[model samples]
Every structure is written in C-alpha cells, then in structure tokens.
Target: MTASRARLAGSTALVTGGSDGVGLEIVRMLADAGADVIMPVRNRAKGEAAIERIRETVRDARIVLHDLDLARLDSVDALTAGLREEAAIDICVLNAGVVLLGDRRRHLTADGFELHFQTNFLGHAALIRGILPLLERSRARVVVQTSIAAARARIDWNDLNGARRYSPYRAYAASKLALSLFGLELARRSGRITVNLSHPGVVPGTAIAAPVRALLPQDLVNWAVHRVGNAPATAAQTAFDAATSEADAPVMFAPSGPFGLWGAPVPRAPFRRFLDADAAARVWREVDRLLS
Candidate 1:
C-alpha cells in the first residue's frame, strides 16, 4: 500500500544517521512523500549542514535535528524521551553506522562498551524499545538497515560485547547480525507492528569510506566499489522501497539488486539462522537481561 492507505502522509518519520549519504537520501524521499523527517545524528553541526542540502531538494520539508550518539546509551535515552514527547512517529529507519579503520587496534565507546555493538546494535535496540510505546500509539513501521557483512559473521551470543577479542570488521559484522536477529524477533514479539531488514549493497561511494581514506587514498576503495558495488542513491532506493512496501509477513529481508550482492531493493535472500526461533528468543532474552 502507498502512503495514502498506509496513512504515511503528514505523519512523522524518524531516520537515524540522517546527516549525509544514503541516510540523507532516505530522508529526502520520505519528506517528498509528505512525512515530517526527524534526523537523529551524531554530530549536530554536520547534521544541520545536511538539512541545508535537503532543503535544496525538498521545499517545505519538515526536518527536525536532534543529537544522538549511538555509542552512548544515555544519548539514546535522551533522544527517545524527547521524540516521544514531541512526535507521533509513523516510521523509523535505523540507518546510522560506522566502519573503523584497520589502523585502530581496538575501539571503545564512552561507556566502555565495544564501539560497533553499542552504536550499531545495542544502542539502536534500546532506542527501539524505548520508542515502542510511541510506535504502538501510532501503529508505525520500522526498517533496520543491515549489511552484506552480516552474512560473513554470525552473532556469537557469548561474545556480543566483544570483551573477549577485538577485531573492528568482525565487530561491525556481528553487530549487523545482531540487528538482523532483533528485527526478526521484534516482528514476532510485537505481532502487530511491521518490522523488516534491508542491505544497501556495497555502496563504495558513501561516507562510510571517507574515514578510511583519511588514512589511505580512498580512490582505490572507491574505484573497486564503483566497478561492482552500488551508488548511495541506489542504496537509498532499496531502503525506501523496503520501508514503504507492504508485505504479507512482518519480517522482510531485501537486498539492493540480484543474488543478494547488489541492485534495486527487493526481497533477496533469507537471513541465515534468522528463522530459528530458539536463537531469536535467546538473543532477545539475553539482550533484555543486559538492558534491564
């Protein structure tokens, strides 16, 4: 169903990591569709700059900027509280993420948790739970942006926090896997709410590679990605399609293009082990205990 039947127009939508890149593109599309776009970004100044770019494309776009550091639980708490009081959000896109450079041996958050897990997985999960009541009131939909890296690493429940060993790439992959699990679990538990996951292909041109380029020439990575990967706009299209498309099941898995590698956003491959109810429940139970 389109926005009219879904009642998306004039309703509020929230996009985490909406400062730039694919997330910003998603914000623009949602704004054009008549949803008030709420951008929760890590750097307040950069986010405001991004809002300027959106204004160029979307006139009269309702965009709200709020500071949110996914690496810190406290920041998520503040964002959820403020948004809950202000908006009856109709959709939420969990799109913010980070890829640590190889030079960094170990990454840690302000609260001393593993950076990737806390920021990309745990922090977002907590925020989702915090905002569940708002979603319930509005009957909203949520789309979690996962990655192809999720297939490379399975979430080892015992090492979720990465206290045992620290590898940035593995840590990132594990976090995405955990998010995929949470998406499936959330759909099952809520039963009434719409929950889905999408992978935005290997968008080599995205801001994700900018930090690595600061260390080494980014052109090499950019070249390889452009040859076979996706554009940020392509990735954004997948996210937008996955979020707006109605499906029979609550949990929808989509990839950018074909064979789960890259293309437009369409239902691609099933997330490995995601259909395991036992594992999903285990993850949910463990996460619940930690958050509690």
Candidate 2:
C-alpha cells in the first residue's frame, strides 16, 4: 500500500513462494493492482487458501496456482513451459528460499547441489533461462528477493557447496550472494528485460525464522523478534518497489530505515562484490553450467 496499488494494472506476474510471508503480501498487492498473478506453490492446498484470502478483499482478483518445487529443476521447467503457453509475463518474482538452521548438516538437492544453493540460486537461474523467451516477449521485470545478509557474505568460490566448511547462516548467505550476482549479470546481459534485486530486511514473521526460533525460549524469542523485525508488509515494500517502480533507479532496492532494517523502499548499492561485473559473470557461468 506504500506504493501505488494500481501501478501494475493489466499486467501478468508470476511469483514463487506466494503462499506466505512477504511473498504473499506481494501477491496480494499485485492482485489488488489488477495483475493476473500466477503463483507457483509447493503445496497446492496452501496456495488455494492464500488465493481465497486475497479474494476476500479483491473480489475480482485473477490468480492461477501451479505446483512448483524449486528444489527440483524439473518442476521449474514445468512452470516455465506453462508460462510460455500463456501471454507474455510482465513480472517474475523469485522469492522462495530456506535457511537450514534446524539442520546444520549439509544437504543436497536431487541434482546434488547444496539445498540452499540449489533452491535459492540454481533453481532461479534455470527458471529465468527457461522463461527467457517469454520475458523477452513482454520485456518483463525480474525481481529477485535476496537478503541484507548477502552484503556480509563471501561466495566461497573454492567450496561453493560448503563441503570444506559450513554453517547455517553461512550457507544461506552464500545463496543470497549468488542470487544477487545472477540478477545483476542478467540485467547486464539482456537489455529488453529489466532485472532488479531486493532485500526484505528483517521480516521475523517469515518461515525462515521458524528454524531459529526452535532453539530459543518462546517468550524471549517473541520479544526479540518483535523488537528487531519489521512487519511483512513493511519489509515487502522494497520488493514491491523493485517490481513496480518506473524510475530509473539503482537495481538494488532495500528498506530505508536504520541500518536498512525497516522503512519505505529505497535504492542502494549492493555489496562491493556485486559491483564487479567479472564476478557476476563468473557466477552466471557457473550457474548456467550447473543447470545444464
């Protein structure tokens, strides 16, 4: 609601993980703006329920739900193919991700890449590639949801899978870093399509917080989360801006409050590494190889 809710009227949008959290907020806002939203949910029932909730407010909302498992590349392909059969897409939001704080052990996807790496980074890479033609047809804006944690992360180029060293936070940070690279590189490569990255900042209500909360006392956890985390709608502003704004702004959008934690959306420089075109290109090449 911070931005113009009617900005995307008469458009088509595809959002990953639209079932909950900031993604759900984005879906709702887009639907309110009169966009035909295509949501790829892992759980069809949960997706239908979210659509029902949105319908309560936007009675004429247009939402199409498709089954997608980002952990599996085949699922990504299925979604891309389905999208191609429809009209050109105006937006694609890669927002689904996970933080394996509940399990410190390194887990791999069916394709053998680290779980977070594959789900957060590689899956998105493959998806954008498969849907490149549709994006080209519409000159779509691609918004990748990254994290502020990515600013502190270093892509362990030598041990991309965390085989040598791994921690819950480290793995998640690396995946975000990779995603940032992909967004920047994609923008550089394709002039017809607009690509941007956004960080929702600290949205404590998000499911990624579930694993960490399990380790803390209920009362203390609730108090701490309330103090540090912005509401999902507030955090979602940066993402919404990146997706719908027409301003010729920086490609990275983040929260505008203290330490980029909470406020309205604003464009900011990403990490220093993200500025390096060479590094971005390198990551893109690596991602392309993995997806191949």
Q: Please, what are the lDDT tens digits per residue for candidate 1 over residues 1-292?
A: 2345334577888999898888988888888778888899888899988888988867767898998999888999998888779658778899998777454566778877788888888888998999998887776788889887777676766777677876778888888878878878888888567877768877766655556556656677656676666777777877787677788475444554555666666776556666778877887887798688
Estimate the overall C-alpha local distance difference test score of candidate 1.
0.78
Off by over 4 Å in 1: 1-7, 207-226, 251-258
Backbone Cα, N, C clashes tallied per candidate: 3, 0
Instruction: Give the alpha-carbon lDDT of every model.
Output: 0.78, 0.84
Best by lDDT: 2
Can you write out model 2's per-residue Cα lDDT over 91-161, one digit (the tens) per residue? 88999998877788999888778999988888888889998988988988999998877888888889988
Clashing pairs in 1: 256-263, 257-262, 257-263
Tell me the TM-score of each prediction against the true structure: 0.89, 0.93
Q: What is the lDDT of candidate 2?
A: 0.84
